[model samples]
Target: MMVSYHHKNSGQFEDICVADLDYAFTNVTLPDREGRWCVGVAEGKIVEIVEGDRLNAQHVWHLDGKLLTPGLVDAHTHIDKAFTAESLGDVFAQSGLASAIQAVRHLKSQFTIADIKQRATQALQWSIAAGTTAIRTNVEADAFVELRAVEGLLDVQRSLSDQIDIQLVAFPQEGWFAIPETLESGASTYVEQALQHGIKVIGGNVNQGLWSSNPEAQVDALFDLALRYNCDLDLHLDNWDSAEAFTLPYVAQKTIEHHYQGRVAVSHIASLIHVSDSQAQVAIELLKQAEISVTVLPTRIKLTRVAELLEAGLNVVCGTDNLRDPFIRYGDADLLKALFLLAQLTGYMANRDLERLWQTISNNAAKMLRLPYGINVGNLADLVVFDAYSIPEAILHQATRLAVFKSGKLVAGTMQDQVLSLHKPDFMSPRRWT
Candidate 1:
């Protein structure tokens, strides 16, 4: 959309600026701001954000005093295994994470590229409707699946590039070195093969299905692949409830040793909560120094040390880990719901805490994925308009997303009509008791 603007001059007219914006959002309340503002977008980038509804463009959306924020980011998910819980049955639900991991094997072997795309597309649609525009999904990349998950998710990534940014992590769910048959054949490991096949992130699971007695060796091998591929590392460390399952400190140490600081993310470090406070602090310090991103799957783990991590001024984000899968068997892929649950679990009731916690799903996740995100000038116009006036209000209620904008285009939204109040408070009328 384009808008023609005329410049006023002394006695003569001049075309100082054309003001060819693709679209503009007016009458929207920005986070922490007092008054309504207008955001102008041109060529898929925000061009201006000025107070008051003065932006003139060919297409203008009046948000009706709703809140506007950067699009939500779901930093961690399992799209390859989404929506397969009932087939696997409720047995894993009773047994726990390990059993769930084992139960999914039967389903994983049957996953075709088309099947993965179909399930992933459904999950992505739910997430998009929930205002998430960026996601990072861990795709299984061991010899058993033989890069089928990677291949399938890459297809989904390409197909949904316009709606959402899908970052694929070549995840060796069954340990990078567990499958001897693939190694005996002298072929490259599936993780490396996946990276070569266009996955820019490497994933490791040390606590689950890891055949290697040397957990540190898996970490080393993952780092080797990450360095070899020149990609980011997202590893699952300390995922269980026991303090003895601790591997986060080692991962942090290796992150710094390999100079992978600020390029590595560790998910589900639940052991941090079980360890002594001093020990947890020591690990947190290493994480801070390494500049590692910590992602907690609030739906999957109850004790992830998110409060302490956030207090340490570390980069902490949250994700919807599994949707109707054996691992979780719940969640609608709504990241706001996950963040709300996180806020409640962490007792983040204060206004400041709630506002800051919103970053976990938006800015912090974007930082983890290294995306240029925000409702700032010159940044991609990926934003969500909420049916509320404040961050805390939105999180507290999981407010409806009025509209979602990706690259300055309207992609998904609940175009509900403006709410009407049929009954008015009759203050002048006497109360029955009175």
Candidate 2:
């Protein structure tokens, strides 16, 4: 059944022929061992999913049998942080890592909304170019409310809404507990305040530095607020090196205790990555049972590896965290780099794990963002078509995204061999709760 569906993003997607459809549409689900073989997008949503026919479209584009995974969803990031970080300096532009840091350190006080807007725009555009459809970036609200970051990204969202997807994970980047714990100061109340202004609360990885007050109490307070606001949770936990930084079990326990439905995302759960084999296994089980997900920033982790943790089976999703910013430098919001690094580190770039790895960048990440459960239709009608047919080959060879569409609109595509790509696949990196 060929249905006519179109979007301003993908352009006039009409009379799509399903004669060459590869996979069965009835089983709309996360990519299995076989992966999403073929999809039928109609009316800005997947409508007619056919089993097999090679589903040639009348006015159609072919994926060349490449793995047809769902669009990417970056579960965690510091986009707003990137905004503040960018104004500090052209960290990436300066090849000298030391020079970049020095420059950024000097300008820490120079960060402004104008700088944020420019940097945010550049970051979002860079992410879009990397096949990420959706991304959740943390925005820090200082005393001034640096609303420009929100306004700039929101404008990017609206402008690229047809092509990219984004979630404003308005986060208090600094620390909720660090500001003297004064309700009058508003540091402790920042998360709630951001939520009040329509910002979703992303939890913090309260362990060291700011968490000096009392890690357990700080964490419990975050959980309590997340439960109270009924919003998603993402945190900057154990971002660097630290063995005692593991709070997954505690966080999971709190989630269960709260009986919360909102998602929990932990960035740089690097602590678990360093745990012993036995402990890692136990932690994985606990995380799985608690329905918690982890986002591992590849570049950052590369700067800080705990060994064998990559070998341990954990639901770790790769991310481009703190790109060209203060903390860690150089990442153009490229999940490709993250995926490549994941393969190098986890040794999962071989057979099934290779395919599974792709899911973390797309399907799994989208699920974490609660896409399937929300208004996920009519979203730019974008698709990432690879030049390769075999999943393993597609990844091994760094298969180019032959074509990228938004709302059925062509955003980026190769001329000779159609390689699908998107500016921000959804402005994100994929890893999900399910």
Candidate 3:
């Protein structure tokens, strides 16, 4: 019993092929664009995007006007230490950053490559299912852990390269120069080794008296390594809850001096929220001049003045910092949940604001990582179709990802037997109060 059907009102038969890209999406709305279009993907790239309901492929998915966006990007996460909260208990779960660091220190020596791989792989799988096609995770690199986390993450990266794009940062959770073990090389030496071994980015912590007694020296050391290794720099700076923990301006100055504009990213910067508007304005302008991107982790710490930074025309993106770790006892490695919390915290309720905020997890994050992103012809076909018509609707409902594609292949979510199904759930409906 063979069933033959023409593609809608076009009165043309669809071409069939036995390949991964032998599918087309019709009646799908692109973000911030009017009307629906048929997007044709082939050979891991977007080939055609025409304004009509045409199949043009073997398999046709009539989205019925669902929003199709580029796959989400989690720019900053500690996947090396993800899913470790249950074993440590509630005391460290709610504790401050110092206590969380202490707790991890006690357990770092016991972390094997296999254990790290198991936990990080699970977190990555959850992220992929949630529509994240790319991520930049920080791996701890210090005397105690040495390069164990880096080695484990490299293995996971290679294993999951087909499903998602993973970038690793050789991060020194403790200060680079504050090692007590004379038997091992300094943190800087280990970071370079990770870079030599295949890490493309260098990470630092600039909390002044905490991460490093001399923040300027630490910044110099990081920049030196980054320049020498020809890698990008990502730093954890001013994450403390005090205005006095100010090293952003210095970091910005260094970026300009080193001619490393657009090659550096800073996370947290929570102290910016405590500083005065005038001081914050100065710092924001410096960041803009340095072309440095700011990644805000809403789940892990109080957000900086996000609205003000965006108003200053600074590149401000968001990330999921931790997943069930000591620092953030609650996380699922889902950027939508992180975005929901960010929207609520920043009061981004307007339509325009929601659309712009959506970019934090998609376009902005990609731009920060220098990835070629978006739903356009010639771009990589890493896209997600959500069960919502508009950006605001998607964010408001934390919309279900109807289908997730990586390199033109279905990696997560539904898309199988989708067009043939008669029984479909109403994913757009909200819960009723009655």
Candidate 4:
């Protein structure tokens, strides 16, 4: 089928051809549909979605029997530190978080703009090939590294602007007030410089300043900067394994006090699992009232009560916090792998449970990041087509993507086969082939 529409860029009428839209999966939760469906694209936006057999257009793609869904969105990641496992040797084996922080600080000292850009671009390519269309990464900005991470990510963002959407958070891994240089130079100045360099979000580590004289003061200062700069907040709070480390309630209170509801997100609050059930409920209520979202990193921490958090009406999302860095030694820039691990850790085995888990990496993460693409008409044509029959089968097999589209244009996919063939005697035991 072919459809005619005006192209947004050329200011001219054009015809788009779509064929065999039958066997399409409209929604992840809905059952498959057999009726033919055609999607019309104009000016990089989905103009119309038709459910009929007779349609016409200039370009036609017959999916045959592929499963289509909204492209994956990674709500949280550390792209700057990706693929650095080989350099650390055995340091990560005996070191804790504190030691890891020190090691990262050392690594940052030697970071040049070219080096950072090369590594970050490599990570983005891996993500794009994995069917991820949008990513929100936290880049470090402190006295040691200054704006190196921010500048490098901005470069990568420009280079891949046509392939994927990248949102960078100017993160002060060291506390805003704990470091003497930051205090002397004024933390706002550092963050403002990062914002000027194209950072869209602001991030902080609440636990970094908790040991200082007054932790609330640091929190207030960070929130004030975010409000003043008109940037969203994504803070790392209460990451300890102790029950008494309760910064979530205070963060919630501050969110309401500053009128920053729905604009604030807290990550790695693993201590919520250690608190008593009643206390945890109270904290969850506070988070709900404040309209604050949560990002859980299952690989970095062991106790993340994802099931309970979801039941409390909180917008719980998942992220690959670190990849082959000091914080974590393993990650392949794949959010589906993260979702699978999260399901196993949280004991979500049922079909319905798996559907909900899928939402965390796709729709839920997209909403939190304020992206425009999804499985709907009149949205950006960013989507992924999988070579599977059902959502469950896709998750179970984790097969390679058939096609990845960004703004109605093909970006990444596997088109050629790479199989090796060798002959062997049939009498040989198959079990001993290895």
Candidate 5:
């Protein structure tokens, strides 16, 4: 059977014939399909996904019974400050969020355009090599770094457009109005400059204003900017340990007030884990009502009640928020590692739980970004093939990504070799070899 399909790549759509596929992946494991399946790609879009060994294409990739999934999406990250651990030195060794923020602010004061570009581009390459096809990174826009951070990331976004989709958020890490200079100098003006430089999202940390006279006003201000600029809102909400600092409900209320239901996302609401059950339930209900999504960075915090958030019917996703930065001293830009940490932190060890965790970094994150690729017919051909049997195994072992495809084009591939020798020293061996 032949079918005509519309192929879209890099926002350009064209009609193509499914029978003349440019490439096909055979003997791959697909969800909700029986036996080994085949995925046919033409003009950088998936044309046919059928249950069979159909490999009659110009190019064929034999999966050898490996797991194939939609390309990974990093819903939340900080690319501007990535890979700055060594430069920050031992000042952040035993620090919490507050001290880390201070150290990063100091570092940002010394940021040069070339330095930011080099570090951020390296991070993007590492992420792409690790099978991330899309990333929504928060670029800081404070009085220190100003618009240079946005410029650095914009360059990376343009350079990697074909290999990965990069969405930049004009993030005011210090705060919107809490910092006197930020407010006096027009913080919105800085964010506006970032938007003018091609940022598609606006980010703020409402918790920075919790001690202020009116924190709700700060949330309202960010929502107003989002509405005015016609960009999505991704806020850093309530990331502390005190339950009293939780402001997710307020963010949700503002989302409803602005009628910005699905366009809002709140990241690192770690305080929710410390709040009372009743309190958390109220916030979750409000989040569900507003349709605001959540992104959890399990490595950056002590704990996150991801299972509860998922059970509450909220669109919960996960990301590698920081990679060796002042905020988080460790990360390899690996989403699988983040997933493993999330499972261990939440004690979600069941098969279903692991599967859900996979979705957190893949499908759920994709939904938040509104990306146009998945394991389905008539979608963009962005996928990752892993050297694992099932989702549980993939999460447990953190298997190597055999291949990664962006718009049906091979971008990264890995082949590893290992050799182990079994030998004992004469002091410990019962029988020594002569």
Candidate 6:
């Protein structure tokens, strides 16, 4: 599936100028722009992005109309949880609660570690199909049973790096406080080990499983550990329909108070939807102040809505947390669906601001995950082109991630042999663009 000839550039052409796209996007991190241009790429570095016809060189490509932008980075995720959720029965169904209860009740003899791996691989494939280049995955870690689950996700992360970038977080789904056992060998310590081995963040869950003292306390403990290690904090906060969850001002408050330098993110927190209007406004203000980021799994969060979060201008990011497991039944992994849904639900497309909420999946996500070179010159040439002529069209249709390039090399394309094929490309994994 070589990209269409339109994406190629002949250095000899007058319209083509070669340099890094970074120069073109100093203000905006990702070059989500449209124009007639050709980007000369080499050694995975974008040598230039300049107006030109096309390069006529052995290693040159001429790209036109299509915008060359940075690969997407997911702000928050639970790699294993998402992978396993898809197979664990459909939580979105009306009888979801009963089904999950039954599944858990019958889970004693039927499940094996290999099963988790299978589910994770399935989910990773879905993400690759959707153009997600990186993710901050929460893994199971706490006592031995759940810890084993997280560890298994860690293995999956390693296995799928060529297609997706993963930041494994050793997360304690159960409480660290009540899971008194965790105090002895808590997930944070495991986080230390995981980080040394490439895990990027420290993660925790509040009001669930072990040590259910206070939600804030759980997050604080994880934040403290993160600060100690100089790592990022990714917490799964109140994920229910209970307004009583987290008391007054939840994730946003802590994020601002802590003023933590490293990344601090809250995943789910659907309970925030139930927060009071006045309080929600305050939380949103605080969140912007702290620069705290969020990840919203549309397929999962749609099960519940934190309307206040949406109203507070805290646009929930679209993520496909679960692939094909218990929590989720089917998985599309296409963010365009999620983004379109978000725009419709939150009125994100009311004005030119369509690009505003668009950040939920693109630029905002990049900031949350802390990728300095996600899409820049002198970096891996990972990029995605869409079937949109204008920004508004891109948002209205939530456009297609029609083409994918790795190392300035097209790996997937909608069209055949042309610089960019306009046809919808096949969602094939490990594809080499001809």
| Per-prediction TM-score | 0.88, 0.75, 0.90, 0.85, 0.89, 0.75
Model 1, stretches more than 4 Å misplaced? 1-18, 32-34, 93-102, 179-188, 208-212, 414-434
Could you tell me the lDDT of residue 420 within candidate 6? 47
Q: How accurate locally, in lDDT, is each candidate? A: 0.80, 0.57, 0.83, 0.73, 0.79, 0.57
Question: Which is better, 3 or 6, measured by lDDT?
Answer: 3
- By lDDT, the best candidate is 3
- lDDT score, candidate 1, position 209: 28
Candidate 2: how many backbone clashes?
57
Rank candidates by TM-score, best first.
Answer: 3, 5, 1, 4, 6, 2
Answer with 1 or 5, whichever has the higher lDDT: 1
- lDDT measured at residue 177 in model 3 versus the true structure, 0 to 100: 79
Worst 10 residues of 4 by lDDT: 22-31
Candidate 3 lDDT by residue in tens digits, 1-434 = 11122333466644323233456788887885788898877667676677878545767788877778999999999999888877677755377656666677777877889999999999999999999999999998887788899999999999999999999999987677754542212477778889988999999877764653577888999999888888999999998889989899999999999999999999989899888989999999999999999998888648888998888888888999988876678888889989998999998888889888888998889988999888876677899988777788888888888788999889998666454232335654322100
| Model 2 misplacement above 4 A | 1-39, 51-58, 62-67, 81-109, 144-148, 179-186, 273-281, 302-315, 373-380, 415-434
Flag the better candidate by lDDT, 3 or 4.
Answer: 3
What are the clashing pairs of model 5?
none
Q: So what's the TM-score on candidate 5?
A: 0.89
RMSD to native, candidate 5: 6.3
Name the better of 3 and 4 by TM-score.
3
In lDDT terms, how accurate is model 5?
0.79
Off by over 4 Å in 5: 7-19, 94-100, 178-186, 208-213, 415-434
Put down candidate 1 lDDT per residue, 294-366, tens digits, no spaces: 9988787475878888899999998999889876788999988998888888889887899899988988999
Candidate with the larger TM-score of 4 and 6 = 4
* Tens digits of per-residue lDDT for model 2, 46-112: 5455444334443444333344445556766767556454454455555464455345434533556
Q: How far is candidate 6 from the true structure (C-alpha RMSD, Å)?
A: 8.1
